[model samples]
Target: MAPDSTPPTNEATAEFRAARDHLLQHRGDIEGARRLPRPEGAYFNWALDWFDPEAHGNDDVALRVVDLAADGEVRAETALSFAALSGRSGQVANWLRGLGVARGDRMLLLLGNQVPLWEVMLAAIKLGAVVIPASTLLSPEDLADRVSRGEVRHVVAESGLTGGFAGIGGDWTRIAVGEPVAGWLSYADSAAVPAPFTPDGPTRADDPLLLYFTSGTTSRPKLVQHTHRSYPVGHLSTMYWIGLRPGDVHLNVSSPGWAKHAWSNFFAPWNAGAEILIVNQPRFAARPLLDAMVRHRVTSFCAPPTVWRMLVLEDLTRWRPPLRELVGAGEPLNPEIIERVQAAWGVTLRDGFGQTETTAQVGNPPGLVVKPGSMGVPLPGYEVTLVDAASGAVVTEPGAEGELCLPLDSTPLGLMTGYQQDPERQAEATAGGFYHTGDVAFRDADGYLTYIGRTDDVFKSSDYRISPFELESVLIEHPQVAEAAVVPSPDPLRLSVPKAYVVLVPGATADAEAARSILEFARGRLAPYKRVRRLEFAELPKTVSGKIRRVELRGRENELHGSGLTGGGESPARGKLEFWEEDFPRD
Candidate 1:
């Protein structure tokens, strides 16, 4: 179908457009963008109020998914224009309504990166149903927990994943996306429904829209609640951070069911009227990924630090993508990785900082001076502050480290309502009139923030504070190291010392020589007190989302050393490939 010859104009859209344009106009000027007024109103439904109107008769390709074969060859491809998607989602919405799905009902959406994921998201929004996105990697146990804790009233999952929910008990409707499932409704039947979906009622700005289960790295996952305005309208800051523009093809390498997926794949790019490009691969191969980027001419790209680290291992200069902007998030990008990419591609990989509870709060937006280690200043619409961890007072002196915080006095629209059903935890997080991020960082004189580590991840050695991220960053710079996690090793004298769990790059042997080389490399780069006293060669424990679970490593260390006594020996625990500083002969 052809796009509408002319775009529709309305007051709500105009307000959103104005706010977006203001940020784009001042993309390089952080202070100026922050000064712009935030968009506000009572009644707003992004799908109906913004997306439908913006997508009407819009022939521009809004979504493109490139499928890769097992051999890393491009097998099949699909593209959906904005107008077609708007119309299709309407049909899905009408069909879902016919199935007795009502407004404000919670639905569990479990699928991979496919067309139905986008269709169902839009359909649920149009129907005013709350969505809980679950990763396909989730186990049956995980599904049951979500079904119970999320109060899910409906489920939309791929046919292959239906079995995972077999033993799960829930009073929800099951809708399958692929081939025929016996007891579930077929999602393919939505096409038979009519277009032009009509909402039962207006979607209020504060209406519950999404419930996200955070990746449980330390404890059980926390249920985060977001309203209609929280993600849809909130990602304006994310769009600004990525420097997205209308018609730009933006590709973000993130898995489905994560907040980053919604941030870039759904809200950020769509809000900017940009095209979302996806390359579906059975497994990630850097060569195939770069080929897709070149084939699609991806203009703006975002990926987690893990992807960036892997990409740098390959010859990045071989493929000169037409990328104008590159970003790294999920974890802070090391300075070495950023510099290598800059040298190869002539484009600096900007670092961004945010959690599932919020949108892009800080980032190295385009046209700004790229800081070596800092994750840039606060993005537009966020008033970021550094508060002392102990005193709870805002830290004004530069170079002093503190807990990163967002004051509740001017909470950005992107911030989540709170941890769902956990008022006590919420109160603790929001204590002192601040939304404590529970992350630690230090600000420079120029207001740039450099991530130290998570508050819980930081430890003390001989009374000196040690940030694992700082040590890990230096450790990865060694050629043999692919990934490293730092945790506190119990000590009888200094209380605790930094210990490293190292994952060597392919072809690197986990021998005493290799361990000595890594420890010596880090010893020269890190301070005396922050030196990695003990080293082990093993795969680091990680959350499903790929975040290192340092807490698990700490527990293992304490469990091994029950008495917290090393006996002044070199190898504390035997048979675990453990290496210590004393293992090497002294000059």
Candidate 2:
């Protein structure tokens, strides 16, 4: 099954490789990377043009997956070389084409971090079929919504998850992996068809390639569409921002079916010719994760802020992996998490900002001066502009707060074409010539941008604007506090006040003493206006993708503690274990 396939000079491939090499050569210089040229391929396919050629005769481990039990015990592990995957994907592509899959076909990919998941994705790319990545955690209702809205004509799901698609009402072809299914085509059947895949025609760069469902923390998930070039070619910034180098072992702790998975696991690593190290655990345990990092000799690493926060709780000094680059994404990273990692590994855990709608727009790239609590400067090719939400005027002064946005007319290749079939939402998002990110931030004099809260998450207290992120960052610094979410609590005199919902670490009780300790710690660090006036300890609600749902916290506060004049007409009942600033004694 060994295939030595190398396509000749493709404009897209050549252009992409040049940019990737330029970024790697000048990893320490942001300005040099910003000068890297964008790709201009009229017809391009990343799998055919970039990956297949790069993977030709290359035996480097492209993907390494380690599965662990709930107690951090390794159960199963797998590794695949670049050449092996390329050949296997070609077989899958040829097999899929025989099963009626055609160009522009829509496919729903619902699986975990298994080898087949990667296989189908590359196969779909080679076949010119659009892919919709859905989490395995989704229920039948969630799958139904995606199936209908995504116009899915083919579905490739894990065998156990096929039941969720039952009676979902789609004419789509059903294919299962992992085991035999009565009415499904086995993905295992692809092996029998040995002919290598050949594309019917050139894949237009503008053709739809990937469709993503946003992790809806605030509202219904939006359908995000990416073109052939958007994610495949657009993640050069992400690779550069992560300081990805060829032949390096890169570990991105993320789940499949999410944007970060594609950004870090699939595209970014392969673009750099690096190995993607995956750790699959039944339950996340810090020790086993650290063990894998050290055992694998991981060079570059990326994880969500939640994972970093948990890692800091363990004895960080215990294992020092040979990690050259570290990054935190998914949410704005807390300063405490960054500091602890730096102390333990002597390498700063940098933070980056991006979303399902775009690639890494802003980040603290490698060799840059790491700034405390700042997400750092805009990555190359992203022209970041801070605009005042109310006045619609560009905010130029340092320390001035504004909505984080990218100019629409000059939008980068990474941005989604637009929210699929939702023109109203698309227009609203692109109002005023900017692809509004709906996130707020303030800039420093030296041009490093700090992430404030989301546009809806930010609130006004006593006529002063408040950023929940600013307060929550200080809250997690307390030893007792594991995680924190800040929301505005209704008040009679000041309209609303900042309130915090805190999650304590293991074995920490949610009692008056614990609340007092966190409150006192935050009071010392935060300003008077942003002080958390009320505190409650509870497990924070989150989206399936692990993002904290601050919107739910805001609703709970309004429904419970709204003022007599604000919304609720009478005094609201206090939540159990809730502690207030007034409940503590005066200094």
Candidate 3:
């Protein structure tokens, strides 16, 4: 109904589309745009209401994926138009319906970045099924936990990954994509199914749609439940944050099964009617991705800090894609990387803040003046309040730090209902009359929020709070250091001191000289209290998603090689390859 500027048939789509168009029209008006219209309706279905209506006769490229060719210079591309995908998904929906996939049935999707993944996502939405998008990287043990906890009724997995489910006890429907499996139904059969599928009934706005498992870095993964409108409608804020526009070729460097993949791939760009581009390589080679961006005429791009860090290492001065917006998420982007990218591309690498539990709450939208080290103000329809965890005081003064939270009374549309089957955890999240983000940030005088670190990640040194991210940001600015993770090391006098576990760039020396130079660099850039006192040249542990697992490093430091109460708190004997600041001369 909205494709040709016609009136929308669905009340939810009408309300969502209105707010979406408003954000696009007034990209610069953050305050005005933040006052987004809430959907006032009893029933809503994004696939049926938004996608189908918007797909009518639309021939624009909806999705295009590129992989590196053997030559490595050229990209092998596959594209699908909006109308084509709409019809394809419709056929898949009908086929899946015949297989007994019904409304509210929890379906697990275990696949990679293939066309079938997108088709299945749309088809599941059309069939009113709850989808649990899972990474192919998860172990069989992890899959077992998800199956048991998620109450999965059906699973759509690649043929290669079917082995992981062999021992899992369940009569769950098994469907495979690619090469014929002995007992699993083939996804190729959907191609022969008739189109023009019909839904059983209208979907209530609060009906469950997506169930996400948080990437467990610190603890066990939490099951985050989102309604039909929560993710489908909630991503309007994400759309606005990314500065998406109709016909824009938006490329988000995220994989299947992640909330971020759905955020930019399924909802946010579609909310803005923008084309989604996915780039795949046998291994992450920045040149191929760079070539694809230039070849496809990419307009907007979003990648995690890991990708951004890798990208700046390439000779970016040579390739200038037609990118208008550059965004970073999944972690805070270092100022050094942002500066390097801006120097080459002349576009600011804007950072956005959100979680698996919600959509984009805050961001540096396109055209907003970039504030170095800040992850912008709140997005549309979100009212953010920073709360002090210790005293339960609302932190209003600038430069003050607190936990980012949403008041329960004014909950935004993007937030999850709660962690599924975990009442105690959910209770803790909603404790103190606010939905606690568990992450901490500091607000500046101009309302820009600079992310400090996770509540657990932030530590104290000599009664002064130390933000690992803040210190890590400065550490990466050193020419040879590629990545860094800071954790507290026990000390007698200071009680604890900042110690950095550093990873050096390729071919860089991992010696005392390198450590001294890196430490000197950080000491010059950081305050005395924040300076890393102990440095070790070692690899940082990461989740499968490429997030640094500081918790692991903290464990290593706490044990300190199982040395118990030695050295009278002066200092533990320096471990192999570890360097203390006092080991080097001040000169």
Candidate 4:
């Protein structure tokens, strides 16, 4: 029996057509679809298979990098053709191969967002070596753990970060990107290697390409394994979500070594044949980033919620950007931020949902209805479901909060294989015939999924479930608030109450007056159970990868309660904070 066929109701967009074509190309053959064979000499090589440097040799606008030097001088880089990058990367690949680096050998890269980083990345891909990108913010202990856990055989890092790997001993080739260091090979000498590289074997699409050490806010970072087909091929959905077109200049504010960096800086734009525009800055200044966007004629822009919050604090209307498409990822964008940006720029901020373990699973695509807080439906070729945490049964009823899960049967290209060296954890994460996302969300009648918070981040107060993200979103609406992280603080009467750790704007004072104003603003917007009961003026703890470590705050709360220091008697200081039950209205 055949399934009932349905007719199209709306005009088919380019993305719809491309997705349909892809599905047709892979239908009834899962193995064939997973192994999309590349033509001979191509063999799933991104440099060769996806991009032909010879054909696009003269296209000088492939990359444009603006370096914000330490001396506050702006060095402009422009018109680096694809052919030049390919040749240089090939030379680097040859040099790395000469250093006894073999196929499938894991190499750790710790560098700034410099040209050498991109060059070495492409080189590693061409050489069929698995890359483990590490953030420069990683301490010596973190570096040692990564080196040991990831089983890295080679290290390529900037000169400044060389001291972090001092005591870690391994039989690994050391290569420095910025300057020549003692006992390390200089990347400048890579030019001496041959400009062409011959692959010893064909790179199968299923071959391991990247191994990411996730930004573990709750626990230790997981070594997430990705295949060649996973990211490069998988991010087609992301390209669709961001509405990237050929020749479009896309600028994303993401540092090197994070998953979002690879998501936007590497795959999404390149897959759409768009020019990658990067502005390397020491710190995130709203004015500078906005000015760069306008000056470069950036057509598309993507950033995390933190940047967006700062951008809203500035006079955004003064800097009218040429941006057509805007996206928010990494963390959920509050409705207030999206509304403000849309009103100022006349462009909607589309929110996307995914993890370090996968590509963009759900996103508000271009030309689609933008639900205020909902992270839109699943992208093409992916299936998303809400399952009960206790029962592990699918929840079809709308508005019911459940654990967000991806179907195990429909293996998407963007998902990582598993957590390396921890099968038990992997099994627990991918249980119940579904890959548990560890995040909680609720699906609407229209299938728009709105994020609640992390499974551990969501807590109960007075027997009512409270999502810190929901409270934080409301708190950030106040103009004085720059960043907010909410956690369940201990309470003797109600068992627990929401406590907000806030970072105020530059001009905003962190006094009782400012606190009272913010509390009033939240009281008017949030529900009785969800209102922030306490506000603390402190910097939020963040992982090395720049994600807010809510777990740290949760631990602090647990400690204060366990030690019997936070319940009844406490003076409210400028830095310290407490709230009364009557602060928020009972109604």
lDDT of candidate model 4 versus the reference: 0.80
Candidate 2 regions exceeding 4 Å error are: 1-7, 563-572
**Candidate 2: deviation at residue 394, Å?**
1.0
- As a TM-score, model 4 comes out at 0.90
Q: Return the TM-score for candidate 3, rounded to 2 decimals.
A: 0.97
Q: Compared with the true structure, what per-residue lDDT tens digits does model 1 show for residues 477-550?
A: 99988888999888888899888999888899999999899999999998798899889999988888888899
Tell me which residue pairs clash in candidate 2: none
lDDT of 3 by residue, 1-587 (tens): 13455533666678767877888888888877877777758888998899888888788899987777655654567899888899999999999999999999999999988899989999999999999999999999999998999999999999999999988987899999999998899999999999988899899989999999998899999999999888988999999888888999999888888899999888999988999998887788787788889988999999999888888888898887999989989999999999999899998889999999999999998768888899999888788899999998999999999999998897787999999999999999999889999999989998999999999999998999999999999999988988889998877778788999988888899998898898889898899989899999887788777789999988888778335536457666665689988889785
lDDT of each: 0.90, 0.90, 0.89, 0.80
Worst 10 residues of 2 by lDDT: 563-572
Error of 2 at 213 (Å): 0.9
Candidate 3 lDDT (Cα, whole model)? 0.89
Q: Which sequence of candidate numbers ranks them by TM-score, best first? A: 1, 2, 3, 4
Q: Judge candidate 1 at residue 71 and give its lDDT.
A: 81
The TM-score of predicted model 1 comes to: 0.98
